[model samples]
Target: MTNNDIFKKLRVALKLRDDDIVKILSLVDFRISKSELGAFFRKEDHPKYMECGDQILRNFLNGLVIHLRGPRPEKTNNKPQKKSNN
Candidate 1:
């Protein structure tokens, strides 16, 4: 499933309304219009505003994850590090 699909699914699983999502977003100081919010719910692609910045999108995802998955975890880089010893 797409990321947006996962988000929407989480929204339903959490019993959160679109207005609820919009409200939570506003509570975190991210201003988004109801029409734009509606488009996000209906979108088959990532919302443009979300893709525009890491902080905003991260905050949004963090909120949703908190609602569905519970507290946020620290992000980790799983990539293997290159070793250089000369």
Candidate 2:
């Protein structure tokens, strides 16, 4: 199946709206306009239909990972203090 098909199915399965999708894509530093996203959902025959590219799909998947599971926690450096004997 094409990337567009996969994207459309995922969107419906996740019950995601345009805004939600935009946010999800943004999670991975991918920026997309609402109108551009709408183009992906349009019927093939529609003049405004825009084919989903591999990069868009890849980014969406990466973003979805962060969306579903919260972003990875930051690492902390904790050094134990040395004891001083008088």
Candidate 3:
């Protein structure tokens, strides 16, 4: 239900280690240290436990998409080329 819970589940389901996650996040230009990432998976009672924020989750999801499907192709101009008198 909580963001942290969702993050934890996804981490397990994806079989992603901390290093893999860091690389995945980089795909979207989201920078995160392994220690900070670990904090999100810690028990709530732990002093270093940090709640996962929506921005982090959203970025991770976006990066994951790129990781699985590769980055989207660059957009191309749709207009017809103008004729030139050679």
- lDDT, candidate 3, 1-86, per-residue tens: 99999989999999999999999999999999999999999999999999999999999999999999999999999999999999
Candidates in order, TM-scores: namely 0.52, 0.83, 0.88
Q: Give residue 41's error in model 3 in angstroms.
A: 0.4
Q: Which stretches of candidate 1 lie over 4 Å from their true place?
A: 43-57, 64-86
Error of 2 at 80 (Å): 13
Clashing pairs in 1: none
Cα displacement (angstroms), candidate 3, residue 84, comes to: 11
Write down the TM-score for model 1: 0.52
- Worst lDDT run of 10 residues, candidate 1, spans 44-53
Residue-level lDDT of model 2, residues 1-86, one tens digit each, is 99999999999999999999999999999999999999999999999999999999999999999999999899887888889999
RMSD, model 1, all Cα superposed? 9.4
Model 1: residue 77 alpha-carbon error in angstroms: 30
Q: What local lDDT score does residue 16 receive in model 2, on the 0 to 100 scale?
A: 96
User: Whole-model lDDT, candidate 3?
Assistant: 0.96
Off by over 4 Å in 3: 79-86
Error of 2 at 56 (Å): 0.4
Residue by residue across 16-44, what tens digits does model 1's lDDT show? 87787776776556787776666546644
